[model samples]
Target: MRHAGRALACLALLSSLAVAAPAAAQDDGVAPLPDDFLWGVSSSGFQSEGNGPDSNWLRYTEEQEDKEDVGASVDFRHRYAEDIALAADMGVEVYRFGIEWARVEPAPGAWDQAELAYYDDVVRHVLDAGMTPMITLNHWVHPGWVADQGGWRSEETLRDFTAYAESIVERYAGLGVMWVTFNEPTLYVYHEIDNGAATWLDAPWLFDRLARAHSAAYDFIHEADPGAMVTSNLAFIPLTPWLFDAAFIDRIAHELDFVGIDYYMGVSLDNLTAARTLTGGLADAQPDGIYYALRYYANKFPDLPLYIVENGMATHDGAARPDGLSRAEFIEDHVYWLQRAREDGIDVIGYNYWSITDNYEWGSYTPRFGLYTVDVQGDPSLTRVPTSGVDAYAAVIADGGVPAGYDPVVPESVCSLIDPPLSCLVPAS
Candidate 1:
């Protein structure tokens, strides 16, 4: 393919990046990122929507303890204009949000006009705010009708999903928004299994359905608007990335216009805390993990552009991190590595902080990963409080990144397993 050769050429030109090489070793501050870089934040539907319609997650929330459903979560469902204004004010050029299938298609063949109009306003507001909208078609929540029909396990589910994609793409084609066919497909399956929607044995069958759905959606989206970008964001598990990729990326590689990576933490011999977060603690983080994730994918899929679709720190309910890292410090540290990845000849075109405001995190709203922390359960006002990250990210957007020679607040760890065999051998000093 055209990109295969480009990937090889990039690898040859950037072999020095094989080590933890900084481009601005002698510079004053970190170098400015490319002018065209896409800077943004993201949110999902079920997680942020308070008065959500019937879906698998809504049902799951009812069955579990410590699982309380707070209405309208920061009220993004109604207050998206305020939120979009907030992101626009920060100077971010993109806002990635989901268009929930459950909300759109309440039943198998029925599509709601008002719900579609609501999203129409949301996308319009995003563009009006000077931010490009990255719209996700499915973000782990499907209509209860689909859930009842065996979710991803049934062939009927894929057919209905493709129809949903078609309707959405045809409706939004004029907006020319970047499209995410599915948000984190690996985790989608994992959640399905975890939520008891499917069994472990159903993974392969589900993947098969998801792959087809994505490919079909990719085609459908393009046919509607050829200029639109389409991809399925992958959650890059720091430890066994190959395992994760095999589970999904390899299956739908050709259909992707770019690689959307949501990298949160890294795994290292010393940084086993990511394991804690992976299991549910959401406590551990390696700020520089973005570099490793980008490098791995750039080399693996050289031809395709890479987008840091989701990357942010999670704290325990808006509390200061136990690591004593401020969100400002955290943002700077991560952005530094993002600049490093770009300097290494990786075609990283965009970066989005995981969320615009805090919302429900799967089972609980305890682990907060928002630039603006909203206390869903504790605060009645549902105030969107700007963390240190808000100003820090704003500064990054304004300056195109930190200044030249600006270093991370935290340095790369020795024996870092973020890149496996190579990272352990040629660790950053």
Candidate 2:
């Protein structure tokens, strides 16, 4: 295993170099957000709309007691209309959601027309609600046939993914939907590698294959839906420089029409000296870190229209953070930073909170990042309870931005040194 200290230091150095560069030179900050900025919310089929389909993740959660068995996650499969209605009420112009590959392709060479009809209905609903549908081609789930055929590790899997991508885009060509070829491809590869669920391919090779798959899908999507924009969303992890491969970026750069960045936690390489570091410290959790992280990617991919495709703070069981950073405060803090990024000339076209409601978070239901919390374990009705953040987000969507001078309402002492400097700070109330 790599030494954590050494790993973090290298990450910090890269981050410093990235930040020191001029944003304009980086090809970011040149374009203002287009009038059609796709402010939106995001959800995955397996994670949010729980309708059992015998996925590897489902089996993993059920077989492992330590993992949270998300049997009936917000039940979006049954309640998409209600959930999407909530999103429409927020005045968001887009709804980014995934169509599970496993559900559509339950067996090899056998596609379910009903599955396509379901998504067609959902996509139509989104359009009817006055929101564009941004569909993710694959959100880390594969058909059982592929899983049985050694998954993405197999060379055949790459061909399968390409075929799958081509089929879906061709099927839904005229829906006026935007397409995300893949969601967090790096994380998906990492998860498969770390969990021993896949073999025969390492990270580098997996990335190479993914790059090919994305490139192929990119062309197909454009050919299928000439008006559609396409990209492969990247999971941004600041201070983990090794996680980034410039060569891979170069390869996919031509293939992408825009950049989808999923910024979450922040880390600094200078763990010992920096006030904020990723090493189990309060600073690691501060929302300003998100701003810096976005700026970093904005600089990295200067010419591309950037969308914060996934971002949200997690709380233990939807409980308030010790620092008094409630869900509302978290949303405000992140939004303030987002506005700052925009003012600085980042071509940020959209923002999608990780989820509209709490769902199965990989293995655990405890770390809730939802605007509405779902009783995953206890409630038979599985009601979605609105968090304090729900009203805040609704207001943000209505205004098309965070209220001017919005800052977290919590006391500075709670965040200690990690709190934003009060010099230009203004309260949102």
Q: Compare the candidates by lDDT and give the number of the best one.
A: 1
Each candidate: RMSD to true structure? 3.8, 6.4
Off-target runs (Cα >4 Å) in candidate 1 are: 1-29, 427-429
| Residue-wise C-alpha lDDT for candidate 2, range 206-228, written one tens digit per residue | 87888899889988888878988
TM-score, each model? 0.93, 0.83
Across 233-321, the per-residue lDDT of candidate 1 in tens digits comes to 99988656777888899999999999999988787776777656546675456876788788778767878999999988888887777
Candidate 1 lDDT trough over 10 residues, lowest sum: 18-27
List lDDT for all candidates, in order.
0.84, 0.71
lDDT of 1 at 15: 64
Per TM-score, the best of the predicted structures is 1
